[model samples]
Target: MSEHSIEDVTRVVDGVLRSRRSLRAYRPDAVPRAVLEDILDVASSAPSNSNTQPWRVHALAGAPKQALGAALLAAFRENTLPPSPHFPHPLPEEYAQRQRDFGAVYYRTLGIDVADMPARLRQTEKNFGFFGAPVGLIFTIDRRLAPHSWLDLGLLVQNVMIAASARGLGTCPQVSFARFHPVIAQHLAFTEHELTVCGMSLGYPEHDEPVNRMAMPRRGVREFACFDQFE
Candidate 1:
């Protein structure tokens, strides 16, 4: 057993968390299988309630990934904004406002006019292809699990993103995939009990891409946090 300094661990962990963001564009280079395996292994350490680790990840690459994307994109083109399978609940006003702000900034970075509905549809379509990343990941959970399990899944997702960032990889966790759950379910051959939690794109980032440079503002601690009984 080896002991480590608290200051060093805090600095390292904070660095990884702060540096992680949802990337929009990725380089064509393939992420080695070994590297993907190592990231998942580290992410498996994410804590769960009563040690009930409830997360399933389907990693896709090559032709299979392309096939899945094509299926979903076809469904998207035919359908008019399919309802979200997992997040059916309405968002709070503040939360909804933040989402709108993100959309505004993201589209602006791509030089898309706010009223260009067709261009917006094209941008949304890109999500199904994992934004051109070399690897695509679909996360699922058992239908029998309670809402708390969703929290556990979220922790695991965060772990995966942070771990990937630490290894010079970029990732985008997308809920847009939830819109075409039926298409995904058919492509992946998921059982009746397995529900799509979300999809993630993983690969090295194309830093020069304008969309990749888009950064959204985050509320400071004073805005979102409260301290009680501080000494």
Candidate 2:
């Protein structure tokens, strides 16, 4: 029975955050079902509006998961985009710029020049296959929920990622999967009322891959934050 100081807890939080990365390549080893459940239980502890906990997750593994990946790939090859239930329009320029920057860095690291559309498409196709991860998770929300609920779901996702890091597991939150939501929902038997927000690939990372070695740069706190009268 030992009590931890605030500093000790903060150190642990920092360690968890440092350990997490968007793991694209993963080892073939299967993550245990119990471990997955425990991580998700920790995620569910995240706060929600009125304690509604509107997040719905569909976790897949083994043959069914593989089948889903295969089907999604087929749809992508056919150049069909899934039906989007609803999403924000006209993303702010700053937000859009950040996204574009990430894409530029990602492609450059992969040695894909801007002229290499085929290579880019192939790289994008890897997402539909979960990047060879054994487990695929689809995060969904009720269509009736407001935009704020999506923020709640995002918190829940962050909890899941951090908890997974604490357990030596790596995760990649893949919004690309949203493009194939109809295929995913149809395969998973989700109702029309449920909208797929995003998907995640969870497993142990393959440390040898150079692509996994790329570290995304982040801005300083002062750059992104503003202090009011306190400053």
Top candidate on lDDT is 1
How well does model 1 score by local distance difference test? 0.90
Poorest 10 consecutive residues of model 2 by lDDT? 82-91
Global fold similarity of model 1 (TM-score): 0.93
lDDT by residue (tens digit), candidate 2, 1-231: 149888898899998897688989999999999999999998999999899899999999999999999898999899768445443566678878887788888888888996789999999899887898888999999989899999999999999899888988888998877878778889999977898899999998887787788788899898978887564
**Model 2, C-alpha of 209: deviation from truth (Å):** 1.4
Residue 54 C-alpha lDDT in model 1 = 90
- For model 1, how does the per-residue alpha-carbon lDDT over 35-78 read when each residue is reduced to its tens digit? 99999999999999998999999999999999999988888888
